[model samples]
Target chain A: MDLQTSKAPSPKLPHTALDRVVPHSESDWNDAAAPAAERHALIKSEAAGVQLNLGELWHYRELLYFLTLRDIKVRYKQTLMGVAWVIIQPLLTVLIFTLVFNRFVRLETGSLPYPLFALSGLLLWLFFANAVTNSTHSLVSNANLITKVYFPRMFIPAASVGAGLVDLSVAFLLLVALCFYYGVALTLQILLLPIFVLMMALLALGVGLFAAAVTVKYRDLRHALPFIIQLWMFASPVIYPTSVVPQKWKWLVTINPVAGIIEGFRAAITGQHFDWIHIFISLVITLAVLASAIYVFRRFEDTFADVV
Target chain B: MNTAIKINQVSKRYRIGGLHPGYMTFREMLGGLVTAPFRKLKSGNGSQTLWALSDINLEIGQGELVGIIGHNGAGKSTLLKILSRVTKPTTGEVELFGRIGSLLEVGTGFHPDLTGRENIFLSGAILGMRRKEIERKFDEIVAFSELEKFIETSVKWYSSGMYVRLAFSVAAHLEPEILMMDEVLAVGDAAFQHKCLDKMNAIRQQGRTILFVSHDMAAITRLCRRVVLLENGVVSFDGEAREVVKRYLSSSLKTGALKEWTNQHDAPGDQVARLRRVRVRTSDGVTTAVVDIRQPFGIEIAYDVLAEGHALVPVVEFYNEEGTELFSTHDTSSNWRRQPRPPGTYTSTVQIPGNLLAEGSLVGHVSIMSHFPATVLHAQERNAVAFQVVDGPAGDSARGDYIGPMPGVIRPLLQWTTETNELSPKSNVQSPTSAGNS
Candidate 1:
């Protein structure tokens, strides 16, 4: 109630047309009176549901790049292997799969060599696995940045995916080497490799978005995430081929979006028969998951700073 | 005037004490999800709502610098957070014009593993700067940080001071139409803090609207022309910076004079002792705001000792109006010094003799400690009691007849004696003549 109207002396500067001699109050803020060149930003609380503010995201794209770069640069900072870890991780996983599934269990991998088949699937699977794991904890890990500055929160998760893509590209080199070592011939179907990689990336991003948002509220996801990823890897056809599954149970495997992508990737790399029905089903499920993940991510984005 | 920022009826509500803790476990979440309907039917509402800010309305004009001053949890940071878009309010809206760069904390996005140079670009981008802008200002930022020799070195090797310098330099170079800063000056050394203030002054001179939130009254008064004082999530006063700061200081003094603990669970103490009541009173046992400088005053600290056979020492610290610690006095009474205190409620009074303190507001801090085992029974309650010391009548107090502001925290009335000699005139004349001859 103690509102003293004694205005402080204004600074001596060149006055613009917007300058006024009157006092500032709630009633004096007329949006129509402001010039068109003057940009205005409004802040509010009740932003419910999913609003993909693409413009805001686009504006902060540079920040996303820097964040992704930071993640990659810091990922291997003190490690002895550095970028070698990216290649070594998937290569080692493929070796273990070939040993356990091919040598011991003797799982059928169609006509393709077991190492070539498993490496192709393992390469994409590692990308998706690392991407989802990193993106799920991205917001919480950067809680300082989220609470201190104003940027699109989606950039944190998206940058995790972007950084994962860098690792994926590096690991892809190892896959090419493995294909040559196994004498697997590349066919025209290999041209569809980028599209399938994009689909797998989207599937990872969708799950990452959902997990990131949920982790902000329920930190239990942080503890349960590795277990979930372990289960998801077995659910996909990374260790074995999708063709070995029984016909009735094949529908259950296709429900996982990564299943068909892995199978399609192996086909593209080793020159096997491409399954159009499986690819189509995987693409549709990936799109649905991506759309809903984005929706859920945007819905929970407003509460991230508060709860995080 | 053209408004730079308009906040209308913005209220933020935070829920308290629900079945769900701040963090949720998978089992608890699953169980809650299953019984949510049943729990909803049984309990009307399981959580209580606290409005951190409620119905706050304000408008800041273009090129205006405003300081926000408040106690902790008075919603000062909340307002800054809402304006900066770091968090959203629960009700109403806020409109901001022009580009806004908010520095809520120093070194916000700094990655220790990254080099100082890499962190500069990363922090710059995090603060909404374009890569081109950072590239342009790269040398200037490095120069300002004074870490040119260590720019390529990882930030983890840099000292905390160097880290703050680099982080602040990047943020300082950010050119925004509107800037919001919250107590970022509290870090770094005093010299660096002055440099930051100089940079802030330069920013102010550019006709950019600035919203500064700080507890340092001197900085607030020096930088901001207008001040908004918030108390209990509402604008308590809005006026010139000096006047509002004075009001805030006096109000804090008034509130710090007395504290009572009705609940033992909520009292300030450890297992050994707990404070029951703390009061500033006159020698006659009357609680008053003003204490005459010629008369003694007392700080009555009533505490209950929860444990027996513990040597508890009561220490009281006095601070001036400027938050400068005047002095600290400890209870060395023979009774407690010789024997351990038994478990019982006890009242201890520390007396401030006349002519010992300057004529200004003095804040008292009370603490209880044990020495042999080196334990603090009760952490010091800073500003537990505050009282003003006014000058007494002329010829009776430390000030004597002078009616002006004293220089130091303590003005002791020391006695002086003068003796006149008959040879003093001759000596003075001889001394002047010898000096003139030389």
Candidate 2:
């Protein structure tokens, strides 16, 4: 090691003598000092508390838009069905539910036609399910970008959630057409559909933030994520009405945020009484999950580049 | 002058091969929960960690183009990552005064299914350009890439050269206040590389700060006024670019100038010949790790000639600092050219003339060939020995009165003649008259 270190300085034989003559001019030292005091950004190993840099996120909102656009474009490109798959996916699922639950199980949907009831539920459920699944894999899928550039890591999972909105809107159109075909009367309550959809998106994004962060550390989630989403669908009242739950267990079913949104979607479009208690519970739960998810996501954010 | 970037006591620690899985399954998490107490009792720290970077401190003034050079795994990329905020440092802090654009990789966020035009926008946005900014520079980026014809074609269908050209063009057109690059220019052909360098030079002239990391010594020397040499996760030296590069090359070559094969069976060779040792030495036959530009040097290759009646030609190829082959020479002795060598160990020496090589490191690739039958290579060793050629007193050498780095691979002292002939009075007087008549 000593010999190696000794050899290092000798290679610059021509400049060694000259370098001693002029170590560094005062102008050069002053130049380096002048700009350092006015630095706009300071990155430290540990940030202060759990505060997320919302300002930075706001500055990079355009990147969020572009990333979301890329996901939507890439998802449809080269597919035979293209944008039609977004509609077909839920319609087919709704058909299966109407056949299996309405026809075979003879499930009651509180006077609403089974197809109308199932399509509305399926639209929101599919968006939530797809958002959760896609956002879980978002960070790992964009590992190339994560390792190469710096942006708010939140954008990856957020983009996944945003991209799913495009699909949700397309599927919602089909649901509206199905309601008209079934002669379902639209009411003032139906104006609240966007709020329910927003809640569902927030719920998905909340869970997705946690899952995406975890997926960076443990990749087994990548495979198990779809299975989790499938199980979560059964847990939520996507196919059946919450009224079908045993009177004693109704409280348990309403704890699922999706149940309230899906149930609210049915009541909204079919002119049923709005369930404020259940909607309020779902909003509280969604906000709680989203808050904690952001906390955990930011906590693990620094390690994503290393772990991924 | 303002400071563009400042790093203070930064360090990065990475977990080495350990059971700490980065991606875990539900089963593993459940299992970990079940055995949490036992695991904690058995091992204090779950995994072994290696510090990739340790206590790095650096400051760059506004408009300064600094180069960071190091051997692989010396934490050059880790430092860049910390600077670019791709990953947080384990300790200390970094500050930047201006909008930073990092090209750790060309086309980093490019989707293969997206067309060239779409990718230009996508990549530009990923690198922190606004949509309007991309729209404004879109045509210039396309022209720079020379990919007008393929702009509508998906990048998946693009040849790799086209992909790199378009990616680099987008990155080159990014007019950030501070730019960080990591070996992205190593892609593409030589001409494209020069174009990129020229673009970087223009960027520097605009008074923007730049941080460049590359293994290409020539590029670093040409583009960077200052260089920081990282060794084993720490800054070993930081000074003038030429001086730092020279230190880096020599330190890297400390063990590279000599290689000995203690075990014959494990040596690099075929059945016909095997290498014993290779060394670079001064004219006095004393082995030296570096050579003086004004002094002659010798490359000594010792090998065993295992078979009889086989003529062997020892060839030495000299490559400049950029890894471009300057020239190749073979020992064409009258004895070896006419006759076959008896089976024995033979030492081949090739002398490099003084003042022939430029003042930089020259890497010699040693190979022995059987030229008589089919010109088959019996044994070859790449980078067998590397020796630095430092500039001696310039008066007697070709670099007379020049204080800057020389340009080419070879700088030779050759004779020159100049003559001045005064025109005859008769011809001089007739020239004006003839021109006026015409």
Candidate 3:
């Protein structure tokens, strides 16, 4: 049905009658607004040479601290066991490994007791495992903040690893007590334990950052990561000493970054001879993986906000 | 004048119906990797690209309070995201001077497990505030939120209002050189909204550049002297706040004084009835988008009843420029008000007298509902038709001789009575005791 009107047939509605209708202003497209000599942030589609700017990271250090603090607070507040769980998990794992390793395999553990031997390796392994696990899901879990706010995206995975450090410190107390109970004497080699721990941390962070970035795009990593970690445990010297492996397969142990770090860490705690070759191999692999992981992470960082 | 933000040829392209659907599973990625050669043979199929923004150029001067107004999908949020560096544009560059803060949402990064006190610090840091800055403004933020008693309690237990209050308070205390807020004030109580408005006004006085995106024309006109209207990822109008807002509101309602659906199947309705048309017309039966304040106008709703034995009530609601619903009316004078409407077409009209609505853009939403047996709303259309109420300054109508801002939802010319009683000496000089007794 047509709209009956006294005037001509019209399909479009007439403009509303108002006093002093404002005309469209001139589109003052200013292409020549000279940039002043002031500090400014320029956001472009392609970031200029994704630099691992230490200074920028230092500026956001407080955010990194707060995010880590938030993770620790929230993680502890939700559970009844709280920090005690950190000690209990590693302690029970050490007990089970000690019992099984002693009964199943007859290998010389030198002078150090099997329990202390397993605990030393287990402590560093557990820290590395937890840090990797935590950091892998960090980007996906904090997708809210990543999409809404602007900060160093790496800080998310970094904070997850940092939170694990707190737990490692607490569980370190359990290792010290085990040493005291076993009447183990203090030695100069214990000073190198921190270096091994640093190597373990570097390896964990490298793997974690890589996993976190990839997990943002492929969430199946979340399901597959646990299985990978479990297999990686057997590959490392968490349960048995690396000497038992055949010479032909020992090269595999050398290339396994965490295997060397774990053996070196146990040696430092037990006052055994340091494996300089293995430690050097671990350092090389750790730095390489860390550098490559950071490169891969920074490459995927720009698209995170859009896809996450 | 120094430039605060210069958006140069910025554009954002998003892939639609892509192979991965935004994110992929590892299984799918591996499968895609295996079938990459096969998929290359069948390329140019599913994925479509959308340029959310297209070479939009804008230069905002420092200390300018600009309001960005647009409809949904008009790329206002995308622009803000690009400027705030939440996401990078597909092409183009945005330059910003000084420290910038963008609040696309309040309480962003707030964990429910954390206490209100912890969230204040966490959220503040997320918004780019320093720890020392948060500590310095801690008490002020708490006071602004009016949530001092529950500051230590976990946010999970706080009411939504309290959460919003806490979130907005922290955001308000941020002292960035440039602040971009997207509809943050659309929450909280009126009093709290006013407090936020006051805080924003104070921020403006500090010569800090602010970019506000909101659909609330009232707030836009109140706070921003300059406004930008975006339509389909392009700047359509950029000028004075009042002029830009008027164009924005009117342009949104420009489908005119008459809306019709000839196809019964495509009309908005259920099985009971379908709305065919909604029209705003003068008493002379001529459709119009503008009406003189001194003349009565009628909003006519025509609908087709598909099912019989249903008492249908045609309703019309009027809203002003500020989005306040002035009033609603139904066909209470209908002959079939108590009877069932037959399966046929019907028309209902509600006449609104002149000088009853304030002089501004008036939008009407029409609906058809049934109240008998069970309440079933068949159709409801929002902003169906809009008309401007023109109240000329001729010393007539409700304004009389007043020539200033008339702030009210309605401007009805109601009757009044007055009596002038001359204050004689007898009553004016009455004693306090006598006045109390009287």
User: Each prediction's TM-score against the native?
Assistant: 0.74, 0.78, 0.76
Docking class of 3: acceptable
The C-alpha lDDT values of all candidates are 0.80, 0.81, 0.81
* DockQ for each numbered candidate: 0.27, 0.29, 0.27
| lDDT: worst 10-residue window of model 3 chain B | B429-438
> What's candidate 2's DockQ score?
0.29
For candidate 2, lDDT tens digit of each residue in B281-392?
8778877666666789999999988888778888899997688999999989887794787878889999989889887677889998887777889899888888777663
Cα RMSD, each candidate:
13.1, 10.2, 12.0
Clash tally, candidates in order: 0, 9, 0
lDDT of 2 at A295: 93
lDDT of 3 at B76: 92
Give the Cα error of residue A205 in candidate 2, in Å: 0.7
Please name the candidate that would achieve the greatest TM-score relative to the true structure.
2
lDDT of 1 by residue, B1-438 (tens): 789999999988766666554556678888988998897787664255677898899999989989999999899999999999988888889999887889999988999999999999999999977787789778878977889999999999999889888998888776667889999888887666766665665566667799999887656755677999999889989998766866677676555557888998788888888888898788889765566667888899999898887888888999886889989999999877936889999999998898888776678889988886666546467778777665632346664533223468787888854332223534555332322343
lDDT string for model 2 (A1-308, tens) is 34433444434424322222121233322334323322368888954345577777877788989899999999999999899999889878888888899889999877788888788878888888889988998999899888889888998999999999988887778978987888877889889888988999999999999999998987887888788888878887888777667888877777988888888877888888888999999999999999999999999998888889
